[model samples]
Target chain A: MVNTSGNVLVVDDDKLICNLLQDVLMRNNVSTMTALNGEEALSIINSSHSIDMVLTDVNMPGMTGLTLMQRIKGISPDLPVVVMTGFGTEQIAVKALLAGAYNFCRKPFDINEITTIVKKGLDLRRNSMREKEVIPFLKVQLHFEIPSDIGFVRSIVNHIQRECGRLGFPEDVFLMRVKLALDEALANAIKHGNKNDFSKAVGIKAEISTKKITIEITDQGSGFDISRVPDPLDPKNLLVEGGRGLLLMGLYMDSLEFNENGTKVKMTKNAQS
Target chain B: MEITTRENVEISIVALNGELDNESAELLRENVEQLINEGKVNIILNFENLSYSNSAGLRELIALYKLANSKGGDLKLCCLQAQIEDLFSFTNLKKIFSIYQDENEAIASF
Candidate 1:
């Protein structure tokens, strides 16, 4: 185990519990701060990136600990989070662990065991920091397959929105344009290519980084001739509903292309560009 | 999508809230269909609360406009969110739709 001095932010509604944990951690030479609720804890986490770990209770008034942890992960994903729960709420703690909490401890816990867990989590975070420093780029990739139903496309777009937000894409027109382009592409793949057949499926893959995002969408059906698509912008075709998707895709993406078969499309957008 | 409707004399003002995407296009279509079926032709679609939209939504809007126009009652739009306005401008639909900054202007033009 890497025996390094670490900082922990302890979040709980009870003042006495905060004081007790602060006292125990101070004696063990681990620096700590106390937050009365999840909101206060998030304020502290956002202002300082120096916090190595978070020890939070499951239930809080304003924002639940689970939500706070997810928000914290969005901001600094490598930071370790440890959840605490009372005896009856052990299930919540287990759910937290499954959702990426480093570990969970029940209430009225032994101080020694909690201290060891915090120390180990901090060490793992420190090691991750070292690895990130040596790495050239951090890429987040997501892949999804869905039936050829327009109803399911919204969830995929929402997933892309979250990933783009986590990757630091601005919450402005650019983000909306990216989402609109994806929605249009997915609709075309489902409605036109796959013919909305339940047996056919659409595949979507997105690779996001701090620099750029690349999205590829594929369908199971045979493709069409790109030249045959009417230009929606033409005065005669302005009222046409079907051709706008192709035009919008060409306008929104930094670069867009299709495979020779036209069954797949790849779009790239540069971050902050 | 949620549609909140109010009647301004003969004009029906329909305010749309939430996303106007592929999933919710049918809801808007059915709502507009009912409005047209009732012979309420002078309509102003208030887009101030619409958070998002896509081409599918755009298609429905075009179809709705045609339906309203065929009945000799025109469809006007007002209070479009910035991104939706951008979409209109990008597609040059701004020329086709009579858009106003507020409901009063859209109503006065009718």
Candidate 2:
């Protein structure tokens, strides 16, 4: 097995299971930290920097694994989380996978099986990180004149999705989140940032670092006050369908910032650590 | 993607062809939703021409099936290609939907 050289957070309420997993992981040269509940795990994650994987039990006393997954996604969207369940329900496994789990392992798992999965997860993370590093900087510039209508937004999203998928990203949550974030950001650039101006075009550039992915969208129309944008969670905007796009972008992206012009937005997501 | 719809007796058959990736999956969802909205409940998806489907397509199909079931109707599938059949098997969707060997059997069952 390949050594990831990073720590693993094993979260479970059961002390015995935690110790057993720790031992198993240690025997394979994997460093591990144990947390009895989600609260502790979150605290550990916040304090630490090099946690590469999280092996969590689905059912826990407080803050179940699924809830923990959501919180972790909010914090580190690229972190690989493997869920282990004793109940072994297909529906629960499927839901966990859909919610961004790397894989699900049933209780009473074979030691070899867990080891193999862990190796595979680590390899996947390494490969993806390498791909992010190798993503070439935007070289050629292409101008696209898109109407400020909804159809234009859909077409742009479709093209982006196809291009991203063709670039070798897996058809999974990572790609989905990128697609969702781009859709919302591009829509904002067109509708709110550019104010649906047909004369001006949006300039898009993608930059990839060894540890992060950044996308910039700039509109050529009049800008708006970034601080004036209303929060979607506010009760006043509950009935609106458009305000949620910004909220979704914030949730999915690691960092979002606006330039002085206020018509340009840059979104970044760090690759798995 | 190619979509062909046929109505026979009490069932509507929508045949899907080509790859059902993220781009084409939304169109499939809209097509099924439109049929359900038109009060055509008993529907069969003929997959003889479908070559590949990823998770997005599967999710759309599941959503449509649930919508049909909630409306006191059923969604059956027929003539699934080998690659598409493997997807159903891997996801265990074969157990969820009524699968038939051909369109005639599916329509007759409906």
Candidate 3:
């Protein structure tokens, strides 16, 4: 094991696995921080600046690995992410690789193999960051209005996911996160904003670039204050099933803010470098 | 996906094949839970013919492992394909489940 000054973020729902990985990486002299799930991982990434690489598991209780990857890319597109999977679902792995993962390894991995991959990913990140001329690309814009039909929201998200796949975006996490966020935002627009009106339209705009992707969803209905909504983690709401969607949006999106009208939300995701 | 169950003494072996995705994961979970509830604790998952599995399928497996462990019984895997093995390796799930080279070895362990 060779000592490297780079820091690593290991995100997984399983505590035992987190401990095992911490031991392995620490023994190799790599600094490590662990998060139990994607939401926590995002907070850690946002608050900490010294991280070199992110190693995350694909599946978790609330936010999936693909979703986490998107958030990470939004914050630091140049940072390298390595994904881990326990099931031989090639589609998901292919998705991850496409999303911007430097590399992926299966579970029950050999210690030597993981160490080598981690070292390589860190090296790539370091080299890329050192190059100062990497210009961010133009932001792509996509706008759609919420249809009067309630069932159409799912189709819209599915269509976006398919379109993202066709575009061959460098990271699959972006697609997944966008899809999830789109689903939540659209649902909120239709159900809450439009009050399930089949006639009202919700406007959507997406700005894409090499460095980040920002999307805004606007509803025709009256707007509400985002801050007034109680936190889902409140003690009395612990058993509730519905309040977590907003929390998820806040966690996954780099920034979730509302326009003055309160009917519009502008969310941004930084592109993976 | 297809599941074929065979019982020898008190040990049960569930042979699985085909793709296990969100659509098929529930069936697998229910079948495993039913067996566990029936007091068939020692189990072998014969993966000699399994082709693929997704995150949903992996969740089901984890649930089954937790159930079996709670009952002091173990769930063992046998004859995993290379790609499937890689998935296990990446997720570190291969650490949680006991794997064997063949069904005979897995069944005999109990």
Q: DockQ: which candidate is best? A: 1
**Worst 10-residue stretch by lDDT in candidate 1 chain A?**
A166-175
Cα lDDT of model 2 by residue, A165-226, tens digit: 44433345345356567767776777676777776677777654334557788887788776
Chain A TM-score vs. truth, each candidate: 0.61, 0.56, 0.49
lDDT of 3 by residue, A141-190 (tens): 66676675556765666665554543444455664355556666776787
Q: Which pairs of residues have clashing backbones in candidate 2? A: none
True contacts kept of 1: 0.70
lDDT string for model 1 (A22-139, tens) is: 9988888888999999889989998987899999988888899899899888988788999989889978988898888999988897987898898889889889878766433778
Q: On a 0 to 100 scale, what is the lDDT of residue A271 in model 2?
A: 52
Give the C-alpha lDDT of model 1. Answer: 0.88
Off by over 4 Å in 3: A1-138, A162-168, B1-110
Whichever of 1 and 3 has more TM-score, that candidate is 1
Which 10 consecutive positions of candidate 3 chain A have the poorest summed lDDT? Answer: A131-140
lDDT (Cα, tens digit) per residue for candidate 3, span B1-110: 89999987778999998866545677888888899999998889988888765444665787788789899998899999876785566455666788999988887778
The residue ranges of model 2 lying beyond 4 angstroms of the native Cα positions read: A134-154, A157-273, B1-110
* Chain B vs. true chain B: TM-score per candidate: 0.97, 0.96, 0.96
DockQ of 2: 0.02
